[model samples]
Target: MIITHDLTKRYGRTVAVDSVELEVREGDRYGLLGPNGSGKTTLVRMLLGLVFATRGEIEVLGQPVPKRIQDVLPSIGALVEGPGAYPHLSGRVNLTLFDAAGAGGRRKDRRQRVGDALERVGLAGIDRRPVRNYSLGMRQRLGLAGALLRQPKLLILDEPTNGLDPRGIREIRDLLDELNREGTTVFLSSHLLAEIDAFCTRVGVMDRGRLVLQEDLSSLRAPTGRVTVGSPTPERVVALLDGRVEHRDGEVLTVRHDDPGALNAELVAAGVTVTAIATERRTLEQVVLDATTTSSDRVEAAG
Candidate 1:
């Protein structure tokens, strides 16, 4: 439901986003993974037309951005920077004002929309409490409620779990999961790998103002069992096992082996002294770190 072609944004000589071409299909719990200052917010802002892009095109819900942003934006619910509210206002009052400020939505159903949003985010019980009295996690939920007040077709949450405790984080995760299951397209940006691993169906990793990797979560985590064989004669052991060694540093070797048992047997036959062999798998954390590390190395080398 969202697409960007060669989209770029720059401030002076600093490029916030560089030639980003991205697509998030309908019903996708797509995660934009990146560290802070990696253009996650910039990209989202450009999509929302809050900040104009320096170049390229954007489309949301089949309508071109900027030109048709009004049409597309009304149907999109976003909490880019997080929730903002009148500190003195009660929770209900705050939500009431937020709903009323919406560019679109039936005026008659404002009460119902406000109540539904509050209940959805578990803020209904604190109706009379001032926002200033609410905890940070509570504020996060409140902001989420405002974004979801319109029951948008697409929900864009940038760092949805920010300021949330573990429990609050899980609550938001479940809420997003339910929303996506109900056919809302969820596009979220976060640096937390565990959150993406648990919540996203697909992910795009951003680094140094560029999209470095994008893939299905399942495909990325497929059972490609790896082994770190610590052996005195690591070279002979790898040669005997005919294993595809992907990474090697010092005497430590990481080899891709479908069957560690078979590889172990070959190593034993070759009489290679093995000190350690532990079955391992790549986690989403590793994938993101590797991508960013490689990109940093490349940039440093060129400099």
Candidate 2:
């Protein structure tokens, strides 16, 4: 569980995280979505107490953060900005050192734990090889193995699939799903909207450091059917629909009506001379763009 109220972080008058209030409930597979440098990472670091907020409050797992961060850390596993390893060291060696470095007094029979982590991330056999020789995806998995070394109860991953190919991404996704099903509350951050749509139970959209929307994925994606109505009588059709239309371009009217047949029938009854009627729907990408896009975002991206 996590909660933040009016949380903000600033660097020399540049606001990285601005008044973000976020909550993650128990058993939530929550995804944090945002463009690059949109404050998602800053917020995550604050949650982990790795970065201090410029203003406002933070709590994690029922304790005030940074203060009780120690009390809650054993329960949390995190992979932020990826993991680093000695280029010359074997994957197994790197993980073993990491285990010793931050075992948090959970240092019992760590050799077996390291083996389990490497096996869990699909790096068991190859782990004895030098990390410099491993593929990008393998290194990413090595980072994941480090996070899993302790069998943490809460997983906080930032762009966990950052450089993986499709197959590797799917592997990571499946692993996260398995972990979540096994009762680890997951807080994931990524630019991969489709992946989030596929695996996340809840989502938070961020733009310019603000949390613009937070909602359950099922309800957020509830089938709101759409239709494209193009008729010679476009004006009359618009009047009939009463501005339920989402888009209008020339002769096409993109309306958000679930029952296309009923709408067509109604239009016919009104003598609207339908030329075209086609179904459409919104994707998570569309929803996120609609929710977070702003003039500033475009300007910032352009800059």
Candidate 3:
């Protein structure tokens, strides 16, 4: 649903986004992961035509951005940085005003649309309290409701779960999953690895303003040629495995086994109590650490 080529953004001599190529397919829950000062927000802004690129091209929903952004924008739902509203107005009033100001969607259906969006984001029965009284989580939910107001084809979100508790985060994740299942392509930007790992089908990692890695989450976490065996008797497992055991720690062993099922059966037949056995795979954290440098916010004295 989105693509960029050698995209760059600079502020005077400092580059906020370096030459980067990005691809987000239709129906993809694509997560953009990066540290603070890594230009993730800048990239999102460029994609939405909120910030013009210094160089290169952008296409969203088959339309070139900034040039034909208007034609495509009405089909996109976005929550960048955070949601905003008239602090003194009720949530329903805020949405009504926003809906009236935005493109498309009929005037007569505005109330129904607002109600549906609010209900979808868990604010169905919200009182007419002014938005200034709403908690942070409520505000975030309000922002999400705004994005869903148009029922857009694609969603571009940045730090979407900020200020949300565990339950609220899960609720948002489940909501996004349902939307994706219904064919809404999502482009999410956040620093949380676990969130991306749990929700995104594909991921892109950024560091020092550059696109360092992009891949399907499944491929990036492909199993290694190893199995982790957890047993009460670690020594017994090590002895039974003979030369196949590579490392052992307490009751856990990292064995050079290709199949976990066969290894489990062997351990059971040998009277070794196996607590757990599973094929080892690269974690999303490992993949990210190997691909990117230190967080851009870190500073060190000259060596």
lDDT of 2 by residue, 40-124 (tens): 9999999999999999999998999988998888788999988889999999899889989984236677788898989988899
Per residue, candidate 1 scores C-alpha lDDT tens digits across 43-149 of: 99888889999999999999998889988877898998878899999888888887777733898988888888889998999979999999988888888988887
Candidates' C-alpha lDDT: 0.86, 0.88, 0.93
Q: Residue 3: error of model 3 in Å? A: 0.7
The reply for model 3, stretches above 4 Å from the true place, is none
* TM-score on alpha carbons, each prediction: 0.82, 0.82, 0.95
Distance from true position, residue 71, model 3, in Å?
0.2
Q: Residue 268 in model 2: shift from native, Å?
A: 15
Number of the top lDDT candidate: 3
Winner of 2 and 3 under lDDT: 3
| C-alpha lDDT (0 to 100) for residue 52 of candidate 1 | 95
What stretches of model 1 exceed 4 Å from their correct place?
223-256, 260-280, 294-303
Query: Candidate 3's residue-wise lDDT over 1-303, tens digit each?
Result: 999999999999999999989999999999999888899999999999999999999999999998999899889999998998999999999999989998339999999999989898898777388999999989999999999987989999999999999999999999999999998999999999989999999999999899999999999988889999999899998888889999988888999988999999999999999988999999999998998887766779998
Clashes per model (N, Cα, C within 3 A)? 0, 0, 0
